[model samples]
Target: MKIAFYGSSLLSSYWNGAATYYRGILGELARHGHEITFYEPDAFDRQQHRDIDPPDWCRSVVYPATEEAMRSVLAEAGAADIVVKANGVGVFDRELLEGVIAQARPGALKIFWDVDAAATLDEMRADPAHPVRAALPDLDMVLTYGGGPPVVDAYRAFGAKLCEPVYNALDPATHHPVAPDAAFTADLAFLGNRLPDREARVEEFFLRPAASLPERRFLIGGNGWDSKPMPGNVRHLGHVYTHQHNAFNCTPLAVLNVARDSMANVGFSPATRVFEAAGAAACLITDAWEGIEQFLTPDTEVLVARDGQDVADHLAALTPERARAIGQAALARVKAQHTYALRGVQVDALLRAQMKGANA
Candidate 1:
């Protein structure tokens, strides 16, 4: 099948979390004999900070940050078997949503892939005229990164004909454990782009734990954190690139997963970090969230924490051997059920089913 995807930067993860997710799933789809064209805006710092060259499996089209440029790109995308307008494209999302739907051929699948479903839903509920909500009925399907029953039901209630989650999963080729890098070594580490919605949680789950254990080394990676103040023991490495994720995860004695408020409330949503950290075979201590166990078994494959005290206690309790055992179990779980190859097959089946239903 020929697929056209419009999303945040595909060549840079600078401020985009969807880069790895796009790379993993789309790359695997290519391996399964699907042709893909990914359209990304040349905006923000992504173009300047690009960390990856265009993949052989994709035609990575970069257009100028203008309405005319996007319209031209969408015109081209409209002819594919599937045309996707993903969340957080970083510019003119409302226009793109309308353009993709308008230009898509009648037989082509016009999809709105919401990488941040919880947040997207909130926006629609807050304002009925939000482009996604307006486009819901016309969309062939709505795909989400996270959200299981509740998310699907919400989309249905909002008038979507179909909704499915293509959850984040491991790309072994990209995220498997690598030798630890000295620069990233720490007792605990977290890699997340600092966003307003997650900063308070980061403080509660990460900063407070650091304060509680002054002697332990804690590392924080990702951009937008350099301006924040931190405890003396915490190391802030601004903007860790995609190539560095494996080493970053491996170097930490244990990594932490703190979900943003929206994702936490949505339950079943697991961020890409969950799979990445697990793929690195790193012991993971995550903040409590509903439906977490469905992804990774708590107290066995992962450790769950309700507060800073819980985080500190878990860190103190895990001996190296115990931590290693947990990491291995988590890694095994992701490898078995959550690799991108598996996800690609699932996506292909869904698309085929949708196509069959369309014909019938």
Candidate 2:
């Protein structure tokens, strides 16, 4: 099957958080003999800050941020077996959706892959006439990054015919345990773009923890944080590249996973960092989110922090041996059941079922 993915920059992680998810899932799909065409916009400085070249397995199409360019790109996307217009494409998302669904082959599956379903659902809930709500009934499928049952149910409530979670998973081929790097050496570290929805959580879970443990060294990697009033004990490494993630994860004694407000409220939503940290065999301490146990068992596979105090306590209580043990257990769990190979199988089943229904 040929899949057309229209999302954020595939060659850069600069401010595109979904880059890792796209690389893992689409690469696996390609490896399984499916063709993929990734269409990303040439905006957001992603081209200037690219960390990777286009992969050979899939065709990478970078179009300009203009209606004329998008019209042509959407036409090309429509030819595929499945056309996905993912959230946060950093372009004219509503316009692209209207164009893609209008132009796609009658037999082709037109999907809205909500890499951030929490925000999407919230928008639709607040405004019934939101563009996504209007598009839901026409879409063949609505796939989410996470939010489990609540997310699926919410989409259905908004007139979605089919909703499912295509959650983030570890890509052992891309992320794994690596030798620690001196530059990123820290007691606790976090890597995420500082978006409004997530900044409060980051402060509560990460910055507060660092403030409480003033003696401990902390590292923050990602853009939009350099200008913030960060703790003196915390080091901010602006815009860490995708290729350097393993080293970033490995160098920290324990890595932090701070959920955005929407994701945390929705529960069961694990960001890409959760899997990447586990894949790299780093001791993971995350802010409390419901349904997290379904992915990684709390207190065993991962440490759960309810607040800054919990984070401080977890950091203080963690010994080298215990941290190593947790990292190992987390790694074992993800590699066994949460790899992209497993996700590819799920996607294949979905495509087959959709194709069958189309034929019917």
Candidate 3:
């Protein structure tokens, strides 16, 4: 199948959290013998801070953030068998959402892939006139990265024809265990871009814990945290590039995964960092959320924390041997059942079945 995907930058993980998800899923799809063309607008300074060049797996087209350029790309995308308009392109999202469906050729499958389904659903609920809510009936299907049942039901309620959650998984070739680097060595580390919905959670789960455990070393790496106030024990390394993620995960004695406010409230929504940390064999401590067992067994494969106090207690009790055991268990579990190769096969089958049904 020839698929054209309109999304945030594929070559940069600068401010876009979905870059890894796109690379893992699309790269695997290409390996499955599907041709992919990724269209990303040159906005938000992402093009200036690209982590990787155009990859061999897909043809990446970076267009100017203009109406003319967007229309041109939409016209080219009409030739594809599948057209995907992923959420959070950071520029002209409304036009792309409606344009993809409008310009698609007869019999072509139109999909809206939501990387952050929980937040998108919240927006649609708050405003009945949301563009995505209006586009739901016209889209052939809706695929989400996470938010298991809640997201599915919410999209269906909005009149979507089909809805499914594709959940995040590890890409072994891209993220795996590496030798620890002194530059990133710390007791606990968190890597996430600062956003309105997530900043408070980060403060609760990460900042509070750091303040309580004054003796322990803490690290923060992401964009927009350089000016945030933090305890003396916490070190801020702003904007760790994609290339440094493996080292950042590997060196920390334990890594943290704090979901955004919407994701935590919706439950069953695991951020991409969860799998990335586990894939690198880093003992992971995540803020409490439902449906974690569906991906990793709690207390064995991962450590669940209810609040800052729980995080501090967990860190205090963690022994080097115990941490190593948990990390290994998580790594083994993900490798056995949660890899992008497996996810790619599942997606290919789903698309093929949908295509067959359309033809019939």
Candidate 4:
């Protein structure tokens, strides 16, 4: 099938959480022999901050975020079998949806891909400025990257034609375990940007642990975390790149998972790091989220940490051999079930069904 993505910058993940999801999904779709045309608005310097070039399997279409440019792009997209207008693309994304749904030729499927459904819904619900408030009811389908059972039902209740949740999956081919580095390696490490709601959780669950473990080394990496005060044992490495994620995961004795407010509330959804860290054979110590057991078996596959004491227990209480065993188990799970290739199969089947319905 020929698919067109009207979404955020495929290349720049610098501060964008959806970067890995786009790369993984598109890369996997390409591997499955589908033609994908990724359309990104020229707004937001998305092209200039390109993190990855077109991987030889797909086409990249850059268009201005203006109405004129979008109308032309939507015409081209009219020829595609499927066109996706993902949330957070820019102001033009609102128009992208309208143009495709309005001008799309017969048999074309339009998808509202919400990479951050929890966040999007929160913004849309709280403020009048969210552009899609009126337009959302007409969407043919709504897809989310990471949200459990509740999110799908919620989207449907809000008048979506169809709702699906695409959980974050690992690309084992790209994110397998690697050798640990002494410099980057630490007893505990976390990789996430600073956000207001998440900062307090980070402080209680991650940094306080570092403070308590004065003798143990802890590392934190991500943008906006550089200015924050840290214990002497905690080292801040601002903004690790996508390519460098494996190294960051591999080197940690136990990688930390901190969810944003939305993720914590909507459970069973782990981010790229959970799978990436496990794929790298690193033991995981994460803040407790209600649905964690579905993804990782706590105490055996991952450690559930709620506070400084919990982090210390995971870091110090577990024997090195036991930690290794747990990490290995986590790795086995990702290898068996959580690769992006697995996700491709799910998405392809859904697209086929949706396409069939559209044609019928």
Candidate of highest TM-score: 3
Deviating ranges (above 4 Å) for candidate 1: none
Give the clashing residue pairs of candidate 3, or none: none
Model 4 regions more than 4 Å off: 42-49, 64-72, 127-130
Name the better of 2 and 3 by TM-score. Answer: 3
Q: Is candidate 2 or candidate 4 better by lDDT?
A: 2
Model 3: how far is 23 from its true place, Å?
Answer: 0.5
Writing each residue's lDDT as its tens digit, candidate 2 over 1-360 gives 888888887888888888888888888888878899999889988999998899999999999988899888988866788888998887898888887788888888999989999988888878877889888777999989999999999889888889999889999988999999999999999999999999998998999989999999999999999899988999999999888999999888999999999999999899999999999999999999899988999999999999988999999989989999999999999999899999988988888798899879
- Report every candidate's CA lDDT: 0.92, 0.90, 0.93, 0.81
**Candidates' TM-scores?**
0.98, 0.98, 0.99, 0.93
Clash pairs for candidate 1: 222-239
The residue-by-residue lDDT of candidate 4 on 72-159, one tens digit each, is 8888877788878888876666677777677666777878898878887787778666655565665678889878778877777667
* 214 Cα displacement, candidate 3 (Å): 0.8
- Kindly list the per-residue Cα lDDT of model 3 for residues 159-230, writing each as its tens digit: 999999988999998889999999999999999999999999999999999999999999999999988999
Name the lDDT value of residue 276 in candidate 1.
97
Query: lDDT of model 3 at residue 283?
Result: 97
Q: Candidate 2, which ten residues in sequence have the lowest lDDT sum?
A: 70-79
lDDT of 1 by residue, 1-360 (tens): 899999998899988998899998899889888899999999997999988999888999999999899888989866798989999998999899999989888888889999999999999899978888889888999999989999999999999999999999999988988898999989999999899999999999999999999999999998899999899999999998888999999888899999999998888999999999999999999999999988999999999999888999999888989889999999999999999999999898898889788867
Q: Which candidate would rank higher by lDDT, 3 or 4?
A: 3
What's model 4's overall lDDT?
Answer: 0.81
Single out the weakest 10-residue window by summed lDDT for candidate 3. Answer: 351-360
Task: Give the Cα error of residue 331 in candidate 3, in Å.
Answer: 0.3
* C-alpha lDDT (0 to 100) for residue 204 of candidate 4: 86
